[model samples]
Each structure stands twice: as C-alpha cells, then as structure tokens.
Target: MSIAIKGGNIFQNSRPFFDEKMKFPSLEELTIINLRGIAELWHLANVEDEFPAFPNSENPGDSDALFNNKVALPAIKHIKMSLVDGLQKIWGSHLDVRSFNELESLDIKFVEKATKAFSLDAIQRIRNLKELNLQQFQLTGQFIERVGFYNDEVENSVLLPQLRNLKLDSFPQLKRIPWRELTLQNLRCLQISEIHDLTYLFPASICKRLVNLEALRVYDCHKMKEIVREELGDANTVEVKVVFPHLNFLRLSNLPAFQSLGSDNVILEFPSIKEVDFDKFQNPILWDLLQKLKPVKELQLGRCESLFELHDLKGRSSTMLPRLRNLTLSYMDNLQRIPWMIFPIKNLRYLKISYIHGLKFLFTASMCSEGFAQLEEIHIQDCKDIEQMLAQESIEDTSNNAAPITVVLPRVKIIKLYYLRSLRSFSSENYEALEFPSLEEVEIKEYDKEYFDLNTVIKKRCTTRLCYAR
Candidate 1:
C-alpha cells in the first residue's frame, strides 16, 4: 500500500534482509518500504554481467543477485520498489507488474534505467490497475518520439487501456505524445505539465475516439510550438473537430506555437467547452477566436503582450459570453482599455482586473452602471492610472441596499503594491467608504509601509489577516 526508499546505505544492508540467498515473504498482503540509501559508496552491482572481466578491485557482485533472492509478496495489493538497483532495464524478462494480479494502484518514479522501456507487455500485466503515476523516470525512446535516437517501430506500442488518470511532468526528452500507442477511451482527467520538448499532443484523427475525456490541460511546456497546425498546411479539417468537441475545460500556457483554435473555414468549435485559461502567452488569431467563445462561463486572459483591443469580445458578438460568471484580466502589457461599454454579463458575479500597466481608463464613461450593478465583486489592483474602483456617478444605488452589487467581492481584500515607488496612497479621498463589508484577509508582499499602516485601514467589524512579506 505504501513504499519509501531513502538513506545512503541501502545496498549494503539489502543483503541481510533476505537469507544467504535473498528471499522475500509471501503473505496475503505485503508492503516493502525501502530506506536503503545509506551505503558509503553507491555501486551498480547489476552492471557486473556486462563488465564481468573487470579487475577484482571493482566488482560489486551480481546486481540481479540482490533482487533475485526469493522475496514472496503473495496477494500483494501494493508493490513499491525504491532504489531498485537492478533496474538498468525496466521491462526485463524477470520484471512484471501483471504478476501482482491484485495490484490496484502503481506509483513508479526515479527508476535509473535511462534506456529501459516500460513495454506494453509490462503495462498489460497490470490489468486491474485503476490509477498509475510515473514521475521523474528516465524513460527511453520506446514510448515517445523525437528522442535523440528514437525509432518509429518502438513508438507504435499499444495503449494502456485500464489507466484512468495520468499526470506527466518534467520529461524533457519526449517530443511527441504517443497518441496511437495508448488507449484513453476511459480517461476523465489528463494533466500534462512541464514536458519541455513536447510539440504535438493530440492525433489529427483520433480526437473523437477519446470520448470519455472531460478535462485537458497543458502547461509550462516551453518548446511546444503548436497544438494542431492546420494553418501551416499540416492538419486536416476534420481532425480538430473530433478531438475538442466534447472538452469541457481547457488550459493552455506558454504554448507559442499554438496560433489559432479554428479556421474561418468552419465555426471554431468546442461547443461543450465551459471554461478556458490562456495564461501569459501570445498566439495568432487567439484574440480573434477567444472573442468567439459564446458559451464559456469563465474566461481568463493574462500576460498576452500582443493583445491591445477587445476586438474579439466585440461586434454583434453573437459569440459574446452571455453566461460568463467570472472574468479575470491581468498582466496584459498591451491592453489599453476595456473594449465594450457593456461591462460583463448581467449574470457576471466576479470581475478581477489586475496588473494591466497599459490601462488608463477601464471604461469610457464615469458611473457607467447599467450592466455592472448586478455584479457582486469588482477588484482592481496595480493599474495606477485608474484612480477609482467604480466610476463616481456610475450607480445611483451606492446605498448598499440594492441587490447586493458584487456581493462576492465588494472590496479589494488583498492589495500588494510591492516596489511601486510611485504609489503615494491606496486611495486619496473617502478611502474608508470603499466597501468590502465581508472582507476577511489581506496579503501584501514587498511593499513600503511608510505610506499607510494596514492596522488602521482595516474595518472594525471584519476580521482581516494580513501577511506582509517585506
């Protein structure tokens, strides 16, 4: 059920745990938590077979001998092997997960076998596996493509059918997501993050085959150039449709190669999509298509240096999000103003506007309250030129009684004007009138304390927890 591998001398002590010939227990249930990193010198005893004729001074003994010792893990519901030295090959003839017929979950990481493959045969062994996580392992060119010496023959391995949830991080060598090798018809949530060299993920033709896929997230992969590069004359028209049709939530970050979602060729689809996060990246037609998201409930746009207008959120905009509940705009170095006079949707409950240095006026008119009065929360931070939270004359009902405007976030709860040498004060007049009757906590980092003492600014009735990291 659980396993831990630690300490510096595990290799030396592993000999005594077993008999004269290593042997393991055969029990109805077994747990092997290794803490054997205690050895003074780390030696690969397993390498002896390959370099057997070496001088007598260097031999550590047979690597497989340590593991070959009979250790019975009968009816083992869990099997964890840490600091397993003989793993110069992951799918060796002696290694198998299927042998643990009762195994339900598997977590394997830091396997030193750099060139070893976790073969389809190895994965097929875990027929009952419900959850599998492989983190920080040195996988070879067997599963993914474009590794230094990859061969297509090894890339065509079969998929893992029983695996439902998968998280991949920090596999820099993997260039392509092995789409055809793995069957993910049952997968519900997929998170692929920090895979630096991964370029193309989804297959052009098999998007619809992943029928059960609900959430697809790709983040922090720097070298990834494109998702489906049809505009480059590469992708087929039909493939993009089948893949993203059923997706409900999608997040793309730092993917510079991903230029557009759909062509004018057809309505940029993703009909079932409910939320999208485009964080800190620039793309071609990204704003043009983002403007077309009609049914999206939450849209977050941040750090797009090329974005200057809401041309995407304009026009009769049949695509304007009518149901959007939360809209977050932050760190858009190029954004100058809010594009539309009609603030967010009447149903919009939370509006977070932060760190857009280029913004001078959020809206053209002051006291522009027609579409914003229904909003429960409005947060504006770090846009020095925007002097007021809400335009002074925008709402006739400043009376706190009308329909609980922006009730969710009535005031700025956390304000960090860190290193903002120009900021003289949070507000110049009637700062006390700023409403956040329910505000409870605040965190300020790297800010000058000479201008205002936080203890004096907080409301008497509300409990505020302030974390100041100066």
Candidate 2:
C-alpha cells in the first residue's frame, strides 16, 4: 500500500485509520507533505513486548493506546516526511526496526516540537537501509549514546550493514558525528551542511575504518576547525599512514577555522582522489598535504583569502601533479608568481589566473621553452602588477652584447588578457618576437597601455577578440 497525505485535517479520534477489512498488511512508500496527526501510526506499529521494556510505558493510562497494537508493517521500504509539524516524532524508543524488516530509505524534515525527547534507536534494527537523510531536526542532545549514537548492542555488529549514503543538514546543536564509532562497512557517500558546532569531520579511527567512502562534502559549518582530527597517540608508539583509500571527490568550503586535516603525529594519504575544490579559505596544511595526493585531473582554489602563494610546489621535489588538466587560481590577493617548472604537468591543457593583485609574471623566458610542452589555453585577468608574461633576463644573452630571441608556445591556441595596468611586453625586451604557430583566438581588453602587437606575433589565421574601456 502507498499513502500520501496532501492537506486534510487528521482524524481526531483514537479509531483505526484503515478499516479492519481493508487488509493493508504492509506499506511500500509513505509521504507526509504537511502537518497531520500521526500518533496512530506509531501506536499501530508498537508491540506490547516492546512497550513493556520502557518503564515510561507503564504510565497511568498511555498503555491503553497500545493495548490492541498488533498492526504488522514488516515490509515497509520507503518513507519521506516533508513537514510533519503536528506529529512530533515517529517512534522515539517505544518502536524499533523490529517491525521495519525491509525498510531501505528514510528521509525526514522539519521535525520540530518543544516537549518531545526523540530517540533514533527506532532505525538501528533496519539492517537493509541504504539511504538516511535528516534535515532541520533540531536535536539538541544525545538520546541513546551508544547503539544509535556510538556503540550498538548487537554483538559482532556491523551497524547499518547496507547503508550507502547519509546526509545531515541544518542541525545547529550537533557537535560531532560518531564516524569512528559507526562500524558501517558499506557507507559510500556523506554530506554534512549547516552544522555550526562540529569541530572536526573525521577522527583517525574513521580514516582507518571507512575504506569505502567515495565522496565527502562539508559546507556552511561555521565552527568546524579541521576536516580530520589527528588521533592521539601513546607516548611511545609508531604512527602509520592513514589512507582514505577510495575517496575521489572532496570539497571544503566556507569553514573559517579550518586548519591541518592530519596531525603532525601521523602521515595521511589519499591515493584515489581525482579532483579537489576549496571555495573559500584554507589552512597551510592543506597546501602542504597536496604533496601527497595521487594524480589529480582538475583543481580549483577560489576566493581563498588566507592563501598567499603556491609556495610548497616550488623547489626540487619528487612530487608530481601529472594528470592535472584544468587549473584555476581565483581571487587570491597575495599570490606572487607562477613558476611553470614548479608544476610537473607537462601536458597541462588549460590554466587561468584571475583577480590576483600580487601576481607579477606567468613564467621566465628561459623556463618557457622547457615547460608547458602541450598547453592549449592561457587566461589572465585583473592582475595589476603583471608586467610581462615571461621574464626577459631569463633568456637575454648579456655576454653576447645583444641578440634577438624568439619564444615558442607551439600548441597554444587561445589566450585572453584583461585589466592589466602594468604589462609592457610578452618578454621584458620590447623587440623580442613571440611566436604561436597554432594560435586560433586572442583577446586583449581594457589595458592601460598597448604593449604587444597582435598582428606581429600571431599568424594571420588567428583572430583577436577585443573590447576596450574607451
């Protein structure tokens, strides 16, 4: 049977919702769109053996509600509640998953009431659950600290064995999620948003246990300080590397207090990640940890006010970002320069740098011929101090008195330059010829002074797109 209560006054009496002769043995899906009394559903699903276990069930007259409760819904699978304002909670502890044998998905929203103490123990027995989502359920404290919240009583237990996806959003009072305590073997994706009090997202134990998690996203968590908490170690023990084994997509945004994700005490590894995004600020360790990541394809660091430069990628190191294709550096006010050799991405396809005021140059002429072999596109905008694309002293032969230099970017096809007040030439010397045989389109807009001649450098087949302030 399927039930969807659109908008109607709930029956006020304590009679059965369905006729006894209707034979509605189990439900496949149930949706509650708005407020309606649902105490009867709980009363019907409750069992006398379950009620007797709760001391509060012995109340003076409340037991009368369940005296004839033998409605069996042993096969209910999907349930979603959009706004059940009249129904405080479905089942606190009076009902457990002992009745929801085939339940697979549960989603609830706007569970707000002033007097009820809701416990989530009702869902633990649902061993077949694959997805669980709770939104705007302003729970302030723990109801069952161990089984539902921390440890389950089921011995040799792998809690929520089939659960694959979990999401928790808008719980302002939640300080932590018991990822370390949950022995879930199949959880694959997790998203937590608008939880203002969580100080850290992962414990060291979770990094060791959650080998199947693929994507993790956390946003609008105002008080979060770190993505992973370093496990406290014994004074004299060895710390092995902790790997997220399968995590491929990671996004951390709008977290002002974020610091190191791993501890100074343990080595961390992400061998399978393909893309990483930081929408706002980040800590120094995030940049430091990138050294250990596997080959990533796309990376974007946007509006990161705390980041000054790509300082860690410099110097001689065995680190390689071999699979990087698209790289964007945006709104970073303090980034100083881009040294192409610092990046080992020889086949890099696209690069963009925008609104970075402190940036001065993209590369030195001497390194340009040795780097960016298979590049296709380049874009630079709103960088006021960028005087040249390549540094001239990098290739000028001072010992030979003077000589003409030709800089080659063989596979370059598209380039855009905008709002650069200080650019004088592609190279420091105004006479050097910059060659782009495969150039297709070029855009130069709103520069305070004309620096490079489009006709002289690009082939006649290339088209220049232009827009000037005047």
Candidate 3:
C-alpha cells in the first residue's frame, strides 16, 4: 500500500498524524511533503512490535515516548522526502537503516545537513540500494565510502553492489573519487556537475571498471581538463585507448578549463555512442578524437574560441559524419567558415548557427558544388558579419567554370533570420541560384520589422526548387 501525506503539521515531536489506535501496517511506499517536524512518521513502520501510536495528550494514560523509540522501515522500497525542513536527521537516531533491506531508491534534495543525516554505517546497511541522488546539499568530507572512496574492501566493503545510478552535484571539497580503486561492477550511469576541483573524471585504475556504463555527463567543472586520464611510464611513449563500448550519450558543457578527452598519445573510442554535445574552447585533440568514433546522429559543438575555421574536411579521404542528422554551432567567436563540402554526408536535416562574430558566410561555394541538405529548417541568428549565406569565390580558370549549377533544399519549410547586421543575399556571384522548393514560412527579425521581399532575393540569387524537388 502507498500513502502520501500532502499537508498538515504531520509530525510534531513524534505525535504522528495518525490518531490513537491507528496502525501503519504492510506499508510499501511513503511520501512526505512540507512537514515541519524532526520525526519522520514513516519510522513507526520500523518497530516490529506495536508501540503507542502517538501520545493522546488529553488522556493521562498516554505517555510521551518520542526519544526512547527507534523505528526501521523494512518494507519501504521507494522514498521521496521534499521540503520537510524540520528533520534534524534523516537516517539519524530515530531511523534504523539495518532494517532497510528492501530500500531501492533514495532522492533527497534542497535539504540542509543531509550529509551528516545518514551515517556511513547506515548507508552500508542497505544491501539492495539501486539509485542515489544528492543535490543542493553542499556536502563536504568523505560523505560515503560506498560511493567510491576507499579501495580496500576489508577496510570498507563495497556497500551497494547492486547500486547502478549515482549523481553528485555542488560538492566543492570533492577533489576526486576513488571509483577506479573500488569495484562497481553494475554501476552504469554517473553524472557529476558543479564540482570545481575535479581535474579528470577517471584515472587509469577506474576507466576500465565502467564495463556497464552507458552515459557520462560532466558539467561546470571549471578545473576539469580531461574526461579520462592516460597512464604513463611505459615503453617509448605508448598510448592507451579507453573504449566505452555501450555508451550512447555524452554531454560536456560550461567547463572553462576543459580541454580534450586525453593527450594525443591516448585514444578514446565510443563505438555505440549516438549523440555527443560539447561546449568548450577549441582543442584540436577533440576533433581528432571524433574521427575515430562511431558516426553520431546528433552533434553539437559550441563555445570553442580557438577554432578559427574548420579545414579538416578539405580533402579527407573518409567521410566522418556519414550518419549525422542534426547539427548546431553556437558561441564560436573565431569560427570563420564551415567546410560543408568537406565531408560526403547527406543525412543532415536541421541546421542552426548563432553568435559567430568572425563568420562572413555560412557555407563556401565549394559546398554547393556537391549535394545539399534535405533540410526542414535553417536558423541563423546574432551573427555580426554574415554578409552572405553561400560565399562565392571567383575562379579564373575556364576548366573550373564548366557549368553554373543550382543547389536545391527541397523540403525547407521554415526559414528564420534574426539580427544579422550585415545581411546581403543568399548566394554569391558565382552560382546560378540557390533554391528552396517547399518554402512555407519566412520570419525575419531586423532593426526595422519592415516588409522585405525575401522571395525576390531567392528568385534572383538562389535557384528555385529543381524539377525533382517540384
């Protein structure tokens, strides 16, 4: 049975909301919200033998047993406690974790002193714990050894062998976790954010332990320079490759000190990864790493200041983005051009570019020489120097001027242009025209929201939808 206490002065000094003669029996799920009392009413379920439910203050026979009684929740599996501020201790004196044999999931947020609430001994008692999330606790010190601190099991046995998911955020004192030294055979998902001191996510000992890990997210770790650290001191500078065989999603953002996954000597591979998003200053090592991974369906790269222009696809033999579908580029101050023609890819459907000050054009004339996207939407915003969509390069050689080709975006339905201060036309003087066949809507937000004939620019500069598109 599941019971949720919505609103009340539920527990005032262990005088639970339940009146006299009421018993909490066969309870499985419990939720308490905004109850300002140190007594967690669920503790009553722990005491095997029935105790006086609550002191009947009006009756002389009722005795106050608040401090003397200790309770254990053996049947409760899932627990969510929110806004119960008066809780002096969570797994403290009143609650006994040894009886929490069936506890599976615990989520505690926006509470104070939650770090000291549950003693390390209490956490080690639950053998079946699966998920633990601690947020906004501002915790310090070795919060829990089971969360990958001590390596030696004889000293501190791996508490939750069944634990699969763990999230720790906003811990400033946490410099590093001893995950590599411990054995977490089943732990798969790990997310650490706002931890400033962590220089690297995994050391040499822990990288290989994540055999079941699928997703890794590290955010706002300003001092974090690498996702994984490579071990050294071997032969003539040998490199080690760490492969996350089942990892599918990886997101790294707001990490100012963040650089590459590892040094050029160490290689990182994600064979099953499908999506990757990175917002960091440009590190050539990162670009070099992407060439070796499985083709991603969604790729976003932003806030990279060192990337002046992407010149890798100039004559690369193998196409890197063979399975790309959605691409976004933002906050790239030094980026000048995207060599769209550099790769032989056609799966792209949506494209967005914003906050690029040095970009003079979106694509080069070389890009139009090849194929175009089966695009549905194109959004270009806040670009200070985007004078043209497709840049034109004047070629003097007659052999290069064999024909004037038209590139068509057949299914373009929505086109949005905003704050493009130096807007010109879509195409340059070299191409015949760039065409959008199925254009339905065009929203242009400029200094003056005046009616501008965007269709006229398309008709004169860009090619209309080709016969196949029509």
Index of the highest-TM-score prediction: 3
Candidate 2: where is the Cα deviation over 4 Å? 1-30, 34-78, 86-90, 94-102, 113-121, 143-156, 222-226, 230-237, 309-313, 316-323, 334-342, 345-347, 354-367, 377-405, 412-470
* Model 2 per-residue lDDT at 2: 90
Residue 23 CA displacement from its true place in model 2, Å = 6.2
Question: Could you give the candidate ranking by lDDT, starting with the highest?
Answer: 2, 3, 1
TM-score of each: 0.67, 0.71, 0.71
lDDT of each residue in 397-426, candidate 3, tens digit only: 334764665667777777778887677677
Per-residue lDDT tens digits for candidate 1, residues 1-470, read: 33333443334423333223222334333333343322111122332343212122222333332232133333555544445433444333333322455656555555543444454445445565556665665555555222332356435544466667777765666666666667777777787877877666654455656777778788887766545433334344443343456778878877655555533233345678888788876544565556656678888878877655445544554446777888888887667666553335556776778888766544322233344444555556676555433332333544554332221223333433333323333323331233445454554444446764665445535443334534
Better of 1 and 2 by TM-score: 2
- The list of candidate 1 runs beyond 4 A from truth reads 9-69, 74-89, 94-98, 109-113, 144-159, 228-240, 243-246, 262-268, 288-292, 311-313, 316-318, 333-336, 340-343, 357-367, 380-386, 391-470
Better model by TM-score: candidate 2 vs candidate 3: 3
Candidate 1 positional error at 187, Å: 0.8
Could you say which candidate leads in lDDT? 2
| lDDT tens digits by residue: candidate 2, 224-266 | 8766656563352567577888888888788776765655566
